[model samples]
Target: MKAEAERRGYQKKMEAEKEREKPKPLSEKILLQNDVIFACKDIARNSLNYPDSFEVENTNSGIDNQNGKQIYYFTLDYSGVNAFNVRGTHTIECYGTIGDLSHSVTHKIFN
Candidate 1:
């Protein structure tokens, strides 16, 4: 019974450590600080020939760590006119880190 109690204590400690290591939910202010919106707008401008007529709607976002580096993921929905003046929506997935401004558009879907 003593050994079992010790094992359970160790397990509880391990569970608490795991919970502490998990990433917390990102806030809108942090997104702005990371320039996520600007990156989305830049992508829209490059993809579509519109003059700032596009609207950026953030569908989802998350934070993760890779190789000890904090990486940010964003999914944005853009609604605006295309190069041919056809109105449509675009879904863009972006991932990058802070400080270097190294954001990249991973995927884009036209609708």
Candidate 2:
């Protein structure tokens, strides 16, 4: 009975995963920090749209910047992203792939 319940849960999880959308193309944007690693297999940065100085790579795993600190990670399965640095102003767009999925991230940097 327990095994059967687990099987059902697994099936539901797989179904939900299949519903995730593919990523989009890349765009231009402003990033505030250096060595910003977007650790994701599904997501990749579009090199053609970016400059040669910007370094982008695919990691087998996710971001590992946090050291012994509690951090929250949110998995986004979509085509667009709207991120704000300070809140209440500005817009910037960046793009990458999420596996075979392509998506864009809009980040705002403020000082």
Candidate 3:
């Protein structure tokens, strides 16, 4: 029983040391509101019909609890005629974090 207790205590100490050596997530706020907006606009222009007719709207930002990262949410509104000569509007919902804007998720809300 004494040997077993010492082994368990040594394992716990090693585990604690490993946890302390792990790298922590960045705590600095590096991205600004305009940066997120610009990234969204760029994505919209590349994937939508008319690049010049889209605008960013309804932007919101919040900190994610799981990873302690800033998450930005916004919508893109496009109003113009497509290649089919049909005039209509489109809305896209987008979200992304500071260091991962290029991989932002965009979903077409309506068309």
Per-residue accuracy of model 2 over 1-111 as CA lDDT, tens digit each:
999999999999998787665454443211211112343212322221222222222112232234553222223222221243222221222223332122333332221
Count of steric clashes across candidates, in order: 0, 12, 0
Which model scores highest in TM-score?
A: 1
Query: How well is each residue in 1-111 modelled by candidate 3, as lDDT tens digits?
Result: 999999999999999999999988644244444555576667666666766655454444454543776565666675556788666666666666655645455444566
lDDT of 1 by residue, 10-104 (tens): 99999999999999997644754357656765776577667477776557778778888776777778787866778777788776665344444
Pairs with backbone N, CA or C atoms under 3 Å apart (clashes), candidate 3: none
TM-score of 2: 0.20
Which one wins by lDDT: 1 or 3? 1
Please identify model 3 stretches exceeding 4 Å from their true place: 1-30, 53-69, 98-110
Which 10 consecutive residues of model 2 have the lowest summed lDDT?
Answer: 27-36
lDDT to native, each model: 0.70, 0.31, 0.62
Candidate 1 stretches with Cα past 4 Å from truth are 1-33, 83-85, 98-111
For candidate 1, the lDDT comes to: 0.70
Q: Candidate 1 clash total?
A: 0
Error of model 3, residue 47, in angstroms: 2.0
Error of 3 at 69 (Å): 4.2
